[model samples]
Target: MRVVIVEDNAVLAEGLNLLLASSGFEVAARTADAPSFLAAVAEHRPDVTVVDVRLPPTFSDEGVQAALAARAAVPGLPVLVFSQYVEQVYARDLLADGLGGVGYLLKDRVARVEEFLDAVRRVAAGGTAIDPEVVAQLLVRRTSPLARLTPREREVLELMAQGLDNGDIAARLVVTERAVHKHIGNIFLKLDLAPTDSGHRRVRAVLTYLDA
Candidate 1:
């Protein structure tokens, strides 16, 4: 498998190149920014492309845009997205076209070398390898109900989706735990999640967050 990497962090890029090469994949190109990434992809037309979620100039969403552009330029180009944080919305954009060769894994997962390599291979083969955390963040019930939420509630949900507990969420949001509790209750009611034990309901809410 031939792979091209587009990441601003030189050390990480070298590490990925070494790992992939050692695992029998060809390291076609290693680039640090968007233009070079696009150029490399077009020139090499590698079997797979690895990209960080942020890149040069703005350093916000450039990598995702580059990946999307490459996929557009070369249909079905397998892409494995790496990000420092969960961006369910961005991941949705990547999958919106419905051409399945996509994978999204957290940057930290690179430490789990074998699984990361497996994700790369799976994506290169046109299979999906969404991080379990990412899926748990996306697939249960919130798509439509999400729109009904006020901005504050939506903020709470975002924090919740990241696996934060109510107390932790309150600290991050600068609100009291009681307020967080009320907001969550309202969120559950708005989403129409039936009343249940606290633990089960939290799990269900996370599931709803996934639905979007």
Candidate 2:
């Protein structure tokens, strides 16, 4: 499989390149910034991309935004986020599409080379490989009933709370109206807002989100 490495750290990027190359994977590109990473993705069309949470310029969430942009350009493009810290907002944004070809791992917690390789392969195969530590932290942070909803569903609910209709939400999210309807249905179900209830399900769902 082909791979793209997007890390500003030169030594770490080289090490990752060497490791993947030795494991029979082709290192198609090694980029240090979001713009270069997107260019590499467009040019190389690698099977998977390994990204860090921080990058050049601000060194904040550029990597996450780049990964999202690359996936937007090439839907379902697999990505494995290797970062030093667990940026909750970044993780949520990466997962907001509800696509399975994603992962987030902490740099210091990766115990072995095998584990890292396995995460790359799993994400490349359109599966999730989030680090256990990442998952635990996310779970601990979500202390409300909203935790039952997926990231995409939460986004839909938030839009609903803003009084946006299905069409408006779809337009804002760049998704089809049918998809937005499905997400609303899922939100109602997950929030336990039964169809038989006297109050409007959408209103109830929004209330739940606001309360959360």
Candidate 3:
């Protein structure tokens, strides 16, 4: 897959470039600021983009804004936001479209090659790959709708938001796949998400958890 990287830190950017290259992904472009990142997006039309949450000039939220804009210009553009901290507001904005192919992960995750690559690949394949910490922070809100979920149900939802499948959730929770399905069914029912909904139930459920 072709990938574009937007990071101000030269060392980190180069490292990521090398890592993706070694993993057989083409590093189409490496940009430092929001403007350049946008330009790269238009030029390379990469299959996915790895962007930092902060960028040059302001070093505040330019990266996030650029990512949002790029997706606006190219709908469903896969974006993996790599940040040093968990900015819940930014994460919410990225997932606001309710479309998959989105990810928000802390930069620390880069140290774990396998996990990081999995997240990238997942997002590239039009899936959500939210960081566990991001999911936890969002879950703290627990507003109406979500408030009806039992504690175990909430746990299952959290893992689901982290982009884990039924098997993965089962392994993580040390439960049977059957048990995971039961909990997911309960979650959908409690959230008033019918099986016939147009969207994927798992994604819709996770969206509910995030939107809560």
* lDDT values for all models: 0.83, 0.87, 0.84
lDDT of 1 by residue, 57-112 (tens): 75657788899999989999999997774444556789667775899998775577
lDDT-superior candidate, 1 or 3: 3
Q: How many Å off is the CA of 203 in candidate 2? A: 36
Worst 10 residues of 3 by lDDT: 190-199
Best first by TM-score, ranked: 2, 1, 3
Q: Considering every candidate listed, which one attains the maximal lDDT?
A: 2
lDDT of 2: 0.87
The count of backbone overlaps in candidate 3 is 0
Error of 1 at 20 (Å): 0.8
What stretches of model 2 exceed 4 Å from their correct place?
143-212
Per-candidate clashes come to: 9, 0, 0
User: What TM-score quantifies how close candidate 2 is to the native fold?
Assistant: 0.66
Judge candidate 1 at residue 88 and give its lDDT: 43
Q: Model 1's lDDT to the true fold? A: 0.83
State each model's C-alpha RMSD to the native: 10.2, 14.1, 14.3
